[model samples]
Target chain A: MLILNVILVIFLIICAVAVERTKDLLGAVIIFAAYSLIMAVLWLMLQAPDIALTEAAIGAGVTTILFIGVISRTRRMEK
Target chain B: MDDIIVKTITRLIVPFIQVYGIFVILHGHISPGGGFSGGAVLGSSMILFTLSFGLPMASRKIPHKVTSILETSGILWYIIIGLAGIYLGGKFLVNKEAGFFMGQAGELISAGIIPLLTLGIGIKVASTMITLFHTIIEED
Candidate 1:
């Protein structure tokens, strides 16, 4: 389990880099949402349900909503 | 550097990452992972999405004020819970004496209001992360 966890962490780290490399801001947001979801799962596996739920709702849900709103405001500004 | 590898890698690893994040959050009471760690993961995930999809795409689904509210509300929830514990005739965050939980270390109800506190913390951290992501992604 420890080894698996390590591998997962490494994977997350790499994905994080992917988020930085992507040019499409929307794609980046999706990846970031994925990142938050994964983190929530990790938290659950680690035994923090409260945290996990918060991550899912606030991190993945509410925050995402906010990002989308901002995106709509500035869609024309993108290259 | 390439889209294919990055996309494939994201597709493969993202699930595991999210699962692990939940694991950590749940295991916080039993181990090192907790609300803070889980929240950080959420923030980073959104950040990644922003980087790959562009800030507009990510922001299109949500707005900055919502995140700000989440952050502040989470904090208020935490303080309210703690104060509730105090109002109930125990010290701030008083667990065993407060009668909010069973008082057993491993028991779900044992931590009294700690879990609630953690929930608030997780929200706060995650929302804050989103706020930061908005700032970075919006920048030209």
Candidate 2:
């Protein structure tokens, strides 16, 4: 259990850093969605299933689409 | 957006997503998910449809006027429910004292006024999400 938690946390950090570093806005949004999914799992492990559900829906699902829409309207690459 | 694979998959999956969202909203009082989360899920399904099939079709499925009406009605329903409590000689948003039916614990219909409140919130949230997404996408 501890090992799994550590792995997830590590992935979370990597995803966060990657999202910031990526020049492609689309890639960043996808990475952020991944981060949201990981956070949702962590929330579930921490016994906050309600928050997990909300995070998964709003973070991974709706936020990703909204970001994609914004990226479509604006520039795909950050520059 | 014109990919046949994506369209086929979306068509196959959207109904299930909507059903799951409704399940979450209806079981909210007894489950971990509530109105807001479930509504997001529901709204996202519509978004998925919009992504796969053009926005025009999606807008036809749920027009702006319809969303406006739904948004207004959702809040109105919540207010009406709250007023019922006051009419019953109880404080605002009162539950059991407001004469609401509280079935057995763990049952679907239990939790006086909570499920109704969740329904109202679910409708409001889902419509709001759709409206926001449509506005942003249609802006330019």
The estimated TM-scores of all candidates read 0.58, 0.94
Docking tier of model 1: it is incorrect
Q: In model 1 chain A, which range of ten residues has the least summed lDDT?
A: A69-78
Native-referenced Cα lDDT, model 1: 0.73
Native contacts conserved, per model: 0.00, 0.77
User: Who wins the lDDT comparison?
Assistant: 2
DockQ of all candidate complexes: 0.06, 0.81
Q: CA shift at B97, candidate 2, in angstroms?
A: 1.5
What lDDT tens digits, residue by residue, belong to model 2 across residues B3-91?
A: 99999999999999999999999999898999998999898889889888988999999999999899999999999998988999578
| Model 1 ranges off by over 4 Å | A1-79, B1-4, B107-109
Task: Put down candidate 1 lDDT per residue, B1-140, tens digits, no spaces.
Answer: 33776657666675676676666556667566578877777666666666565667677855788889999999999889888879885688666666675566876545667777777887788779778758744655
